[model samples]
Target: MLLAAALLAAAALLARGLARIEGELARAAAAGNRPARVEFVVPEGSSARRGVPPRLAELGGGRALLGTPEGELVVLRRDPTSGELELERVYRLERDPERHLRREGAPLHGWFLTDVERERRTALREAWERYQSALAQALEDFGASLPTAEEAAAEVARRGGADRLLALTGPEASALQRRTAAIGLARAGYAGALPALLVLLRDHQRNAGFFARLCALTEELSGLALDPARPAEALAEAEAWLRAHPVRDPYARKGAASAGPVSPPR
Candidate 1:
């Protein structure tokens, strides 16, 4: 009788360990996908659902539920158009288990400065100053010989200068350089610079301040002699990119919120 009891206990423990391992595997697979949508729910005094999408559903082998270390629920899914897995929505599991079970990935939070708080502020400050200096130099070089507005605009179009400006800087310095270059190009009436400027605007990992700068540059550029219809389309593309790949600084949790479904490319 004692032997039987021990065996039973051992079996139960094995089963529990297997279950835990399975749950972790499921979460890992889901996190790997980083889907556009996810839903989650938190039960009272328990872990919240991390929200995995259905595309990752296969990994769970039809088991619809998983738990986080904190006991949060998770669901996963695949995008219909791209067939890419994403987390769609999330909710509190205790309040509505059924709904939470069905929830998908939510709009992920953007990266904030707080996420990188441990970094030396002085280092970051110095880096930023250096970036500004490089940007200033690029702008000056690009516009150096043009004596008149028309000549400057013509020069920007002929040089394919935005690419050159971007090449001159590192990723850390690219944002400032891009923005300044865009402004300079726009001021000179360089409609050709719009495509490259648009690319920078759509980048997800760029800091919020940089996005604001892009917006300002876009507005300034839009006022130029270029075709007015294109800027709207350009802005829309940038917004779409942001929604699909929401930027988050690993160190900072703050990032730009999605503006919602982008208008289909016209």
Candidate 2:
């Protein structure tokens, strides 16, 4: 009886929180939204460089993204006929940024960073810096022992060794090497790799790229991206997924065709 009462209280609180969110959304929908004017930052030595820039339609008609006052990314559509840019078709109440890109390999061109997203990215950058710093310290301690980032990535893609890839992600390897291995595991789409990826995800050294790549692999492999915000829940869900899809190949049937196309966390 006590447990049931607690669950009911929790449900009521959730409903109230949701109601407040819905009210805010309704109020915001009634107001005008503005786009931010800022330059895009292409990460130094980053793999995904095809981000759509704002006013790309000025060069030619292309689908891009726009940041609005509402702190969300809205798809900017260009009319192929008139070469005019506008918001995507019929996006009134429903405005989930991920919905903007329906195609599997579509490039998310323009960056629309909200204050919240900026804060999040700043934190992520710091985490990456810390991770890289730790990696450099480890590298100084152990000189040139394991394979290079390019070599490790290539090896994992060429030969289906999930264990080898997992090892490369450990503390002994450089950040570049570790990122490449994680990207390889995701792009290779190996069923055996999925379990290892989940373990790595749970290991959770604030691996920002891993989360996005996990979305890519989960979607590509099972046609699903069931994200649980919390890491523990996400691991549980992945375990459930493994149980559901038992008969998958150990490696990519068609090698790493895509150069590790990553998507936003869903």
Candidate 3:
């Protein structure tokens, strides 16, 4: 009798676990199915069980569901207020190497709802787009190779390019863009903008020699004294440059790679 009772108890525990899994699956489908830990893109109004694109996973499939190596699903939908597609939800999945969900396998084979990292790249996308658009506009306005190209480019700067680049250098920008903006400013003869690049390091405790090698790179472009020694003066120069001119893509210069070779400060 005791042996029979123990077997019954085991079966009861298994049934409860399966029920919990079923509930979780229902929730995942309703929430928009996708694995939370894996970085995958899912379109709005699609079923995760069907299949979705995986960044670097070998695709696998089972009788019940499609799977990636990591096992999960993602969903994206347009925000009504913003009218932009945002990452709507992510669902969990069993780490099945087969890369497919097995519905017949009962409750253990599919998605769960647990992830903390916000799955969205909207801000990064927008930032990169704006930077590219501005560069393109500036280059178009400058129209390289004209006999008076310098004058034209300088005029574009005064109209607004210079001030715009400086504006992007503010703390509001991501470190990547800020570095690019500062380098552009330096190449445009605004040595003062080098200061903006320095601040991105986020390490106030670093000594002088370390900073000089870093800023030394841009010092070549501006032709002005970029002494990290006197930050007050550098800032003043930056402000003055900001007031006077904007950014221009000096494509006339030989060997200018898109945004120049400026790396972000470490």
Candidate 4:
């Protein structure tokens, strides 16, 4: 009789556990299918309470019923007859934690969405247009040159064209254009253009040494004489510039080594 009683007790416990699991599943299904209102609490220093919706959607799947700039609330519904659960509408709640903290005189660190789609799109479009225009102009000038021009036309075409472009437009014209040409010449190992870039670097009126340094480093890596004159004055000036504003490019160290030790400006 004791053995039979023990077996019965074990079965009863098993049934209870199963029932509890079933109840939890039902609750989860209902929550997924039902509509809910949500409230979001944004952290301090956030530009906008915008990312919550997408993050919630990803976490909850398409079952998210409502989403607001502040937060999202979702409902889970279960079909009584079919024993199936579905997610209903989600409600978004908007609350700015930073604003609240500010009101309460609490310290808050600011947040900025650096990869915002709209801002990225605008930047890309502007860059594309500017570089395209510059490249078109350079090509046109190349076409205008005579078949048998002064100096090696092919070499000039290769090295002098970019320098000419930089001279005409000046380094301050467009950041995108300057960077694009700098990168292109750097990749091609064009050293002849370094002289023009150095001139820009020396020009106090144009604070474009950073761009020039990038170009110079590229040519330097190609085993070219960046400053052929090695004039004491120019060397001094280059050294002074380097001291004031160290070159950040990884390739610059190599350039510096190749150029020899430059004395600081007097």
Candidate 5:
């Protein structure tokens, strides 16, 4: 009777252990199936759905000041391993010179900056600076030098110069690289590169040439010279104008004539 009781108790303990193991396994499976919260950053002046910037991975730690199509400024932070970007904060960029200068100097990530948060923001700022430096180095290393006005024009005249620069506006290019490409495209007279430039400006407001080069390109591409002195107003006005006057294909209407039915031999 004692032996029989011992066997029954052992079986109960074993069943409990098995049940716990199964539960753990089920939880692990569920976690593995959950998708990573990765988001693609869209370019500034384009549709939110069009293109994903290549610089997304490099903009990790949510240090980037990203802009949505609606013109809202957002700070995004990402998990290093999971590559998931979570919204850390949002700020409405003020256009007024005094307000803009004041707000630009204030803490962007939070209402109040603790020592730890301050350190983090500083680190992020350093990272951005480093990335920008690296981008300039990369472009030079790639031999697409755009040092002066004359050099830029000559570079664009070279075979694949415009194409190579245009390619930099793709997902792989950094904000600085994209901005450089925008200038090159404008100099190349490639109007198609306008949207990419606009998107770059929208997505990265902190990037250099945000107002100067971008505004110039906008005017050249769209033929609507905006007031560059007021960057905020100019950006918004140019966006509105571009929306109203979309670049139609030079041959879209022409295709209709070719598609019509031909008469049979009579």
Candidate 6:
């Protein structure tokens, strides 16, 4: 009798868990189906040779639905007073030839309706991840091109600040490479990477001689002098300066100089 009671309790718990899971899934689905924040959409007309022309149907009460031949359903809801048409939702329908036609009364144009934002966010995330991987690979390549620690120190001692980082060790080369990358990032409008670059600037693993070059690079880009040894304080100061004087993307500016090798601070 105890064993049977215990089994019944286990089953009840299992059922409750399943009910909770179902509720969570339902909530998730509802959230996923929420209306998309649309930018502007231009009508892309289709020729007879190109296939079926695009369809635009009014759902009454200042609400219009546009069915693109490419299986995109856009719901546009206009303001009652202002008459400004705002995009309510964007859904990618499953490929159904019959449903693509103008139907009298249909729940939806297709069987499955996938939210555009979810798909877009997923794709953007994947692309961003790929970009991060590429950036890491580029950094590794830069590091590979550098000389050994002993060689870099000797080179720095001989040439000082005027000398190009020609034969530096891996650690030393990384510092110069990071400086160059940081400069490039600043020029390219990747201000988000500033913190990472600042961390790299103060890394103890890098040769001490490379700090001046890194500091010089930051000063050149941001007009804020960074003490290479005290990266934490330097980063805070740099951040404050950046908040006041934002780094504008030179590339985006008209008649800006083309990107090239970033020279270290002399």
Q: List pairs with backbone clashes in candidate 6.
A: 147-168, 147-169, 148-169
Better structure of 2 and 6 per TM-score: 6
Candidate 4 regions with alpha-carbon error over 4 angstroms: 1-32, 49-61, 65-130, 141-266
Model 2 off-target regions past 4 Å?
1-152, 159-182, 205-209, 228-230, 252-266
For residues 1-266, could you state the per-residue lDDT of candidate 2 as single tens digits? Answer: 22235446666764653343333333333343222233333333322244443121111124444433333455555466774445562221233457437767543653333344445556545544543454464367552422243333444454435556667666687555565566556566544445545655665525555564554555555445556455566667777877866634554333343535432222
In the order shown, the candidates' Cα RMSDs to the true structure are 23.2, 18.8, 23.0, 22.2, 26.1, 21.1
lDDT of 4 by residue, 105-185 (tens): 543544322223444456545544544554455456752322112112222223324344334334565533343343333
Residue-wise lDDT of candidate 6 within 133-205, one digit each (tens)?
5446545665442333222322222222111222222245555544433443433333333443455565632
Model 1's alpha-carbon lDDT is 0.39
lDDT of 6: 0.46
What lDDT score is found at residue 52 in candidate 3?
47
Superior by TM-score: candidate 3 or candidate 6: 6
Candidate 1 vs candidate 2, lDDT winner: 2
At residue 243, candidate 2 shows an lDDT of: 83
TM-score of each: 0.22, 0.32, 0.25, 0.24, 0.34, 0.33
Clashes of 3: 15
For each predicted model, how many residue pairs clash, with residues at least 3 apart or on different chains? 51, 3, 15, 25, 7, 3
Error of 5 at 47 (Å): 40
Q: Which ten residues in a row have the lowest lDDT in candidate 6?
A: 249-258
**Candidate 4 Cα deviation (angstroms), residue 83:** 21
